[model samples]
Target: MNINVERQKMADRLFLVAVEGEIDVYTAPVLKKELLPLTEISGTGVTLDLSRTVYIDSTALGVIIAALKSAARNRCRFSVVGMSPRVERLFTITGLMEILRREKIAEGDN
Candidate 1:
């Protein structure tokens, strides 16, 4: 997997993280490392753009949940966007959809 992370400043209190890659056990740590800093930003919100991610495994999901918890502790908003159908299904089957923010968008739209 190829992973690329880009940060865009949406506003003084909001930031967006654009991620591209397959987030499996091997790559989940990359995401965690990239996002850990955001957890320290008290009250600032973060939106994760997962539009380009092709695959994710349980380990990745765990990492994401951990990130969300960290965000909550910091009083920051955490949202996920652009999950592919298969990935969305995985979240649904795993009951993560109810816990994590899942944004619906047409494929290739983002």
Candidate 2:
């Protein structure tokens, strides 16, 4: 799975997390473990970069949605970005795109 989390604090209010690897049942918990604590911190919006992720299952999606709800409960914003085509299709088909935040980043930049 080789999951790597690269965090960039965009400002006092925003933090971006670049995630790389497979986000499936085996690895989704790793993400949850890492991200759950962030929800406890006040007033920080997290942007998860999934550009390098090769796959995601329903369990992974559930974890993400759970994270979003956790963030909301703590008054923090949660977002997602850089989905691969297959991942995007999954989100589309599952109707998760409407609830999750997704963005496209330009090439050549982190």
Candidate 3:
């Protein structure tokens, strides 16, 4: 599994976290540790990129929700992007799509 975090310490302070492979119970903690710090930085917005992720279990979802809550408390913007079809289905089934912002894939692109 590969987890990459990109933080822009500029006006608006954009933070992008990208994850590859499965994000299950074991991997969720690693993600949590990485995600939590984004909220600590002053003036930040977070974008979680799951474009390369193969799977995400309930635990992983919980961790993400927690981060969203933290972003709210800190008054920082938060959104998620690059969701695969399976992941998108899971989020839809779980009703998480209502709360999380997902970047739309352009037509004619995989």
Candidate 4:
């Protein structure tokens, strides 16, 4: 499947990536390329909004986990938000929900 990834800088220290469509092996690399750089922004906070995502696989999860680790090493805050029920269940099943900071972003509240 395919995915569309868009980004917005919410503030001097806040960055956001909005993803739509499936996050599978095919699309995971795109996400990694976009997300890893954001994590390198020292002292910044990076958020991944997956509200519109329809699917995710292990490869996608790995990309996110790598980004999370990179963020930690760079002193950046990384959060994953707006997960649909199915996606949230995956996170729970994988025990990543406990590790990831899950928060919802209100419309226009960035």
The reply for model 3, stretches above 4 Å from the true place, is: 1-12, 101-110
TM per prediction: 0.84, 0.80, 0.80, 0.89
Question: Which residue pairs in candidate 2 have backbone atoms (N, alpha carbon, C) closer than 3 angstroms, thus clashing?
Answer: none
Task: Let me know the TM-score candidate 2 reaches against the reference structure.
Answer: 0.80
Candidate number achieving the greatest TM-score relative to the actual structure:
4
Between candidates 1 and 4, the TM-score winner: 4
**Candidate 1 residue lDDT tens string, 17-78:** 77888888888888888776886689887887888888889988887788777887887877
Error of 2 at 68 (Å): 0.8
lDDT over C-alpha atoms for residue 93 of model 4? 90
In model 2, state the lDDT of residue 106: 21
Deviation from native of the Cα of residue 77 in model 4, angstroms? 0.8
Stronger candidate by TM-score (1 vs 2): 1
The C-alpha RMSD of each candidate to the native structure, in angstroms, is 3.7, 4.3, 4.1, 3.9
Top candidate, metric lDDT:
4
lDDT of 3: 0.74
Residues 1-110 of candidate 3: C-alpha lDDT, one tens digit per residue: 54444444444588778787889887888889888789766568777788888899999889877877787788767778888989888887887775664433111113
For model 4, the local distance difference test gives 0.84
Off by over 4 Å in 2: 101-110
User: Which 10-residue window of candidate 2 scores lowest in summed lDDT?
Assistant: 101-110
